[model samples]
Target: MQWVSLGDTGSSCPAARSTVAAFRSWADSYLTQPSDELGRDGPVCPYVQPSIRRSLLWLAQVPAADPRPMWVRAIVRDALEIYPELPTRNGSSTSVLRALITVFPNLKDHTLIDEIHAEFKTKFVERGSMLGQFYPGCDQPGLWNKDFRPLDAPLPMLVVRGMMTTDFPFLLDKPEWADAYVRKFAPTLPAHVRSVMVGRLTSRPALVPAYEVRPDDESCSTSS
Candidate 1:
């Protein structure tokens, strides 16, 4: 639950500070700039620049030397508990720009990190948040291009942020996840996207969401 601004990680270990510094550089140079290899005409992460400008990006260190699964899970649970209290902008669409990165500098087990990410991602999505797992040499591929690895950061960390309509691609494959997306964005989804969701829902009639998705909620464009 120990959150710190990128500018200061008070009393944090040298390893923690070093990891934070590396992430700062990565966000500044890589995330905030466009790359030809990315197969898109924007930065690696479009929200990053606004996030940095608004001072909504935060970092937390899990100073665990042993890296046991139970202990790591405990820190992650704490992070989830505090995520709602993190700073956010005034507009509903603006909340998605904020991010909380929980770093595990001392953890050497990349497999365990992946396991934890997989185990917790559902819970995050259910709560209207997205959790991203990043570690050195991670093989997860980029969205627009299969060859690009957008998530291979210099450290092992989990990032949490408010979910946006742009996340529909990630949710469409899973019924419960798609249900969550529909619950939040059905009212504002573009016609094509709604058609896709309707097709998906009809295909699995038995797995339909609990609520009768009504087209009445805040407006969120596809670009959001």
Candidate 2:
């Protein structure tokens, strides 16, 4: 919904700008739909579809050094909100996550997705009867074990990038540059949360040698 001027149009072609405008229009139309009517509508709701489109557009617009904007969170939340059946949205979450990764590949780490999954579990799953709201035909534990599990690895990096970009500024002195740094890393962190990513990336412990194995190493074998 936020509109910023495309400064320095010299480098961009007219066709490209037109395409961008078209995409934005499409997204705007999608987000404006009524939530109550989304279910009776079908697989592709006008509201939800535009959010997905907007997500992709925003991701393309992001600079390599800058973290994604806070607006992106709302965009994603809106996308998820349109569907009545949790299963449909939950399943689409995977696609959404994948789209994010395609934009920011560094977010391939499972740790980030795990955090999002945990939040979903705490927010929705803990409420017992909320199960039907997410998935129509499936049970809670089954959905958790199946769809949600596989989704963790491939979730979109852009979503994590947006989270970090939006939150990191309040936590640091050089908020602007720090946001850029966080985006570059595609870290799954809030603005104020200190990330272990740098430490993990830089620090390596000396590897100890494995115990020498003898040719007839009976100790190594387990007795049947």
**lDDT (tens digit, per residue) of candidate 2 on 1-224:** 32122232344445445434443453345333433323343332232354453432222332133334344334334323422222223435322211221122233333433344333422221221111111112122222123322122111332211222322322232323333445444544543344443332223222211222336755667775
Worst 10 residues of 1 by lDDT: 210-219
For 125-155, candidate 1 gives per-residue lDDT tens digits of: 8888888899889998887999999889887
Per-residue lDDT, model 2, residue 98, is 19
Q: Give TM per candidate.
A: 0.83, 0.21
User: Which is the leading candidate under lDDT?
Assistant: 1
Name the weakest run of 10 consecutive residues (lDDT summed) in model 2. 127-136
The best candidate in terms of TM-score: 1
